[model samples]
Target: MRMMHNFFRIGGVAADLPHGWIDKCLDFCDYFFTGVVEYQKLITRNPIFLEWVEGIGIVSGKEVLSFLFCDFIL
Candidate 1:
């Protein structure tokens, strides 16, 4: 917590707070589009990740929706 306190400043909805408020601060961390390295690691490790996915060939976006169950799990 000490390391993160200096890295970011809390304001507005987050004003004077307590140690327990650390969980609330974490709400800002919900992020998408992680980076190239992380992206590659994501798709490559996903068993259902269709490597041949290109030009919308093998499956349309709708067809793939049925298989959606889990995310990348290590």
Candidate 2:
């Protein structure tokens, strides 16, 4: 109940939202977008990020198959 809030049901929500909550959510949405833009400017535009991530996840088909079929129990 603590995690699920007990206000959610199979069909829909079991309770109406509190007053002013919608405005708060809308404000957060705007703030979150600005934060995303700021983060992209700081991280995605950095040359080090490209150098760090380039050629990082290269995987062969044999490695993929071995990983998929490996037995982990020992």
Candidate 3:
């Protein structure tokens, strides 16, 4: 990840991977996270929301509103 970040920083453009790489990466992520979600379900023995937010730490609704609308005023 650091290497990819540095590559983009120096190149000043998005790095294009070979064809099918994006799809493969997405597939792998889906598989791995699916396993994690299943394990969480088994361990917790409870139903979970299919869509949920996590790790959105220390966010203020007012701050978000201000930031979102700040450009409109300018």
Candidate 4:
């Protein structure tokens, strides 16, 4: 969190990540309490929204295999 404060002081982005999974990203856990509740609020019963997002960022089968070993920690 101190790193984020420092970046904010310099007018840079306080956070970034390498995934399409924003709701499950580490930065939210780093800052927000009840992150799961917040995530559910945005997508509750919203299948159309989810489908649109998946269409835009869908991973290819080969790419998924290549990235299967990448680690994501929360």
Candidate that scores best on TM-score? 2
Question: Model 3, which residues run further than 4 Å from truth?
Answer: 1-15, 36-57, 71-74
| Higher-ranked by TM-score: 1 or 2 | 2
Q: Write the per-residue lDDT of candidate 3 for residues 1-74, one digit (tens) a residue.
A: 55755566654756678899989999999899879978887656644443233444567877777789984653
Tens digit per residue, CA lDDT, model 4, 24-63: 6666777676677777877875788777676586787767
Query: What clash count does candidate 2 reach?
Result: 0
Compose the digit string of candidate 2's lDDT tens values, residues 1-74: 47567777889898788999999999999989978977888788889987899799999887777788783531
Best-to-worst TM-score order:
2, 3, 4, 1
TM-scores for every predicted model: 0.21, 0.44, 0.36, 0.31
Candidate with the larger lDDT of 1 and 2: 2
Q: Which runs of model 1 end up more than 4 angstroms from their true locations?
A: 1-34, 51-74
By lDDT, who's the top model here?
Answer: 2
Cα lDDT of candidate 4 equals 0.67
- Give me the displacement of residue 39 in model 4, in angstroms: 1.9
Q: Runs in model 4 with CA error above 4 Å?
A: 1-31, 67-74
| lDDT per model vs. reference | 0.58, 0.83, 0.70, 0.67
For residues 1-74, write the lDDT of model 1, one tens digit per residue: 54554545555333467776877656544443336668888687766575555345567565566557343331
